[model samples]
Target: MTVHPDRLDELVRAARAGGVRGVGRRSFLRGASVSALAVGVPGLLAACGTESQVQTAESCTSEDRSAAEKALVFSNWPEYIDRKGKKMPTLEEFQTTSGISVTYNTDINDNTEFFGKVKDQLGGCEPIGRDIITMTDWMAARMVALGWVQELDMGAMPHVEANLKSDLRSPTWDPDRSYSVPWQSGLTGIAYNAKYTGEVGSFEELMTRSDLKGKVSLLSEMGDTMLFMLLLEGADPEDFTEEQWSGALGRLEGYVGSGQIRRFTGNDYIRDLNAGNVVACEAWSGDVIAMQYDNPDIKWVVPEEGLSLWSDNMLVPNKAEHKANAEALMDFYYQPEIAAQLAAWVNYICPVEGAQEAMEQVDPSLVDNPLIFPDEDFLANAYGFMELDESTRQQYDKDFARVIGA
Candidate 1:
């Protein structure tokens, strides 16, 4: 379903007037309030599920439902989910067992644009016109702070509560997970074409080596690239302050200004790296996996300095029309067997604990891949990006635009 531009703006205006200070606070309150209202409205709950069922984290009984009945409206990135000629069994099972239908859509291509579209409405009491959305951890944190998401019902998601990675829980963004649930986790590291880079061993080798100057690319996004730079500079991302960020930005500006740097990129880095047009660039761990499928020579490395551990989470929007169904779907995905299928297909880090073993049952070869199941040693070198305050985010964005624009 498309979010009308005008309507989204109207909602944003309403939310702005409702004393919502930021995107997170606004979206959370708006989603919760709207869901609460919809639950109270006669016939609304009945239309979605049994009137007396009272859907909560603890109440989603997966029985006597059809695949089509558990229809969920999910918004995600393009090509992110598994499909076989239009069939999604994992989602289909939710429909069959819980009697909930899922209308999955992939309309979110950019995070900033998506936030801008719904910021207003979520600030108010209206549903943000979406049941669920998947976005990066940093953006999720922003939405959580604005109150644009619903606190997950852990009781309903026992599988998730039990299986989710320890590090992913109690994040600084949503200390108690009052707003979001991690859909997948991955690392930000160096992806290089071995043929072009000639035995590149570290991040510094790509950035500082004279031979590789003008051949390397870095992520244009502030969070992904800057955090990597901070780690290289020996700054602790988890404990960094505004002063440290300023220092990181300054160093990044120098790299950008010099002719030593190539272009900044996003997913295009994958294409460029695969084609040997770019030797090394900052890349998501999952994208690297996809690239490797085509070019075995491509190498993804977590620098000796360390790398960023990132998670993109699923959230129920404030203006969601089907919160109960949405919550049920969330809980359903948390199941180990179900989550394994998604992780195997998507090739991201599974949040569910036993998902790796479940995936091994499906395909034994996948169990040993570090990218899919990061080991303790590798994880020891990973750090989640720290949350930036509004002012810092604004400044960082400005600097990022300058680098990309130049």
Candidate 2:
């Protein structure tokens, strides 16, 4: 989920109430005018800096405090961890067993926003006061690219190596899995109120259908919505050229121009969707899965083009005082039993390989759920967005913000 800039974590409660859950493009318009986006988005990005231009923290290091500190702060999305009335069972057990004090903060409501908060401290080779921060693929890549994150000691994370799902093993940004490890995987696809809009099987229909016009929303995340637009334009998001990005951006501009898109949003689309104020929109598979438990009108569909596959990654920020303890926690969660336990409650794609078998003991029904345990068919249609270079990411962010009038 992208997020509301001011009250970024406001959607966190909504995400937890249902379940744990949890783009683009380029230029050529260099010759053209981006009056609205150029005008409206100047301040929207006050929270985020130019990611590509962020200074690399080549000198960042923290003292070995783990032996005595014996504590770490983990910032993850809201509702991502399992809770039993003020207690996160797995985390509590980890602290008890390992004798590590853990401070868990759910303040990471959006990738760009969180980066904005910590960039200054990180760039100065200082601490952002956290040991770990879990973020989506693109932002994780940006942090890794900028050297804002610390490298993991894979030797200490043997379970991560053995149990990490094959598909999530490598991201172009962290090709060697040195800086980032996936926390959970999810699919971004077409979601709609079946009772209102029928089947929105493609982005084209969602952006053009008469009934959906003025009643539809799209994700605020550039990668999620813009990559879908890239696919809608018959381009591969995993690898595409700037010319391809320009075409997709133009198409998106047209959607907003038509007023077919009521607003660009993060997970808050679910609220409007449930109220029927929105008939259809882009959505994440997990959010739809949680919504369906109460309302049958909710539907999730992989577009004819495919599903956008992404992961929220666990990364140790540079200068973290308890890197070793943080490594211990990461390793603990990688254990299939622990991963499956977290997955059962959150209902997102689990990143552990043996978690499916582990889920059998937890919930036999989830074993066959493609959303939880994706089969070959689901894999066939899932696509990951291309990892953008720094310059490209900076430009694309501006372009996407402009189009969404953020």
Candidate 3:
């Protein structure tokens, strides 16, 4: 049964607050019975009560070959995966050997919208009908807290355990990766047109320089933009609080009122920077690489105050149908050779530790590119945004929407 859009948002907000698994026990049983009647699948309904009901990777052994044989339905953002001429060898090989059909879909257009669409089904006892999905770090953390995501069985993903970067291994959101795996990472920092603004040494310079009064832009994303602002304000990103958030918002609103911002943007900042309409703007590290490839004059800077180091993570929705196949796909991408090819195409920071060395063997130049492999010193100045509680998130969304919409 489909969920109403408005109710879905409420459920997500509730899930974020209550934790995905903390729904009242009686309510869970009721939802399961209702779902059984709606789907008319009694056997599936029988498996919907306690933690035992959820399928762990180990449970999908030779005994459950039939269920595991079904195709894995994977979903992610557009252009996030590797593909060449309609062929994905990494995926194709999994299909060839594992005898599991793969339906890779890019249906996630925005985080809040995706959360709204699937939150209800995931909150219920039965399967959410998706084996795997990718989402940004904060959203992934929310899903994990709600217990709407399954704890990955690392034993089934040996490649991931061996090859994933140690730094990415123990994120504050999901320490030890109990719920998610980083798909790729990058920094959110300043990107400026060299022709318009000689050289940007700091974020403050980019925002307040007299010459760039109305030509500066910042990201429209609440978490991304706020984290950068907090860093510039000298707040510790790892332990930011509501008071700090309020201060950052006040500073941002001041800049907005003063005509210091050209506009808050997403990918549009890329085009504007290229056209020289914007002298400086907030930019993703990977996007800067793309822009520089086209025009050498555009430069990305990890601000002196620091930058937000972010990642998009892969997670298994609670009670996914094809759990084994999904685990296999996760392992497939972690293989260094496969990961190298993906990094080459996407140009994001590879979370696979050895993927860069593997890529250098394939194409030597990628080894020294700072954007591809941010140096230790550069990483020293980067920080991950702390996860906010439900109340804080609402406050952030309200403040952010007003700033952007105004």
Top TM-score model? 2
lDDT of 3 by residue, 285-347 (tens): 877776676799999887878878889998988667666777888888898888888777667
Model 2 ranges with Cα > 4 A deviation: 1-58
lDDT of 1: 0.75
| lDDT sort, best first | 2, 3, 1
Candidate 3: Cα lDDT at 108: 79
Kindly provide the TM-score of model 2 when superposed on the true structure, using C-alpha atoms. Answer: 0.84
Candidate 1 residue-wise lDDT, 263-288, digit = tens: 87655677788777788777788877
Task: Give the Cα-based TM-score of candidate 1 against the true structure.
Answer: 0.77
| Candidate with better lDDT, 1 vs 2 | 2
Candidate 3 residue pairs in backbone clash:
19-146, 20-146, 21-146
Query: Using lDDT as the measure, which candidate wins?
Result: 2
lDDT of 2 at 42: 70
Q: What are the RMSDs of all candidates, in order? A: 15.2, 16.8, 14.1
Model 1 poorest ten-residue lDDT run: 57-66
Please give the distance, in angstroms, between residue 284's alpha carbon in candidate 1 and its true position after superposition. Answer: 0.9
By summed lDDT, which 10 consecutive residues of candidate 2 come out lowest?
A: 23-32
